[model samples]
Target: MADENAEETYDNFEKQAADQAANLVEQLLAALPEPETRNKPDGGLNPVEAARRQPAPQPGFDGTIASFAVNHDVLVPGLYLSRQDGDIATYDLRLVKPNQGGYFSMAAGHSLEHLLATWLRSSAYGRQVVYVGPMGCRTGFYILLRGMKQAAAVSLIREALQAAAAYNGAVPGTASTAECGHVAEHDPAGARQLAETAAALLKDWTAADLVYPA
Candidate 1:
């Protein structure tokens, strides 16, 4: 009886996730500058190819811009160039699809952001780790690294992700009132799984994945 109840609960969770994903798909399709295609020209976009997507400057908002709205349909989970100025490069480190791939609960995204930011700031390439934060969309993160090119940036992120995947210790700085906002919402275990999933997707990082849909 207990097992049956647990199975039913799991089914409910899956249903909820599926329903949420479907709703998001509708929203993304409506917002995209380009229409969603049933098939990608090729199998699909590979690697950091998405790196070339730069947000066009908005009229106002103090020079703030939006990401390439057209390519939202093609954006996949991986490293992509967000923008660059001099030695500073911002990357869209997508973990979930814009609307359909996977969903990160708010608590999960928050914990992952905290842990990832902490890890990146302390890694061997820590000097280049400019910033690591979650996107408003909650599908992934925006990572800014200084003094690194695309390939180097990918390597740095891959290593950091591997670390996050293997992580088993307490999430640093997530429990202190003075240290974080909503610190009690941390979910280190969930965060680790997200990291592991992303790392697997990038294990064989290749040049093929470096080009966005043409």
Candidate 2:
């Protein structure tokens, strides 16, 4: 009976997550800029030419971004080097499978972002840590570092996540309104849950695993 109830609950959760993901995708598509229009030789609207000549939405940027180019269908929960710009290396700390009906709630993602950022910024390799933040999709995080070797970066991520899983006391830097915009939205327990999950998935993870699955 207990197992049956648990299975039912899991099914409900999956349905809710799928529904929410679909809605978010809809909203994103709705917000995209319309393709620029062009006049045909006969003065009728020419959509094909318009789309081909549409200015890049972001200034000076051409072509699909690196993150979008990744084949999300095969991505799994693990650390990956998303890209590198000069000395900066951006690491994708994927905690959930992409579009798999599993995701971090906003509160959980918010809390984990704070915890991980605080810990990583003060770690031994802190000097090389450039930035730490969550992905918009709520599936993972991106950490940027400079002048750090792949092996060192791997160890750094493992240590930071382990610390987060074992963390106690107040979440760092969320003490007041000045420190955080949504102070009450944080869920430290949820953050710890996510950290533990990610840590387990990354157990025995090596620099070799940093490559995104082909």
What's the TM-score of every candidate structure? 0.66, 0.71
lDDT of 1 by residue, 1-214 (tens): 9999999999999999999999999998999775454576533444354444535556765653546542877777877777777999877778887779468878878878877888888877888888888888888898998887678778778888899889898888865788887878888888999899988988987635655444
Q: Clashing pairs in model 1?
A: 46-209, 47-209, 48-209, 49-210, 49-211, 51-80, 51-81
lDDT score for candidate 1 against the true structure: 0.79
Steric clash count of candidate 2:
0
**Candidate 2 global lDDT:** 0.90
Total clashes in model 1, counting residue pairs 3 or more apart in sequence or in different chains: 7
lDDT of each: 0.79, 0.90
What are the clash counts of all predictions, listed in order?
A: 7, 0
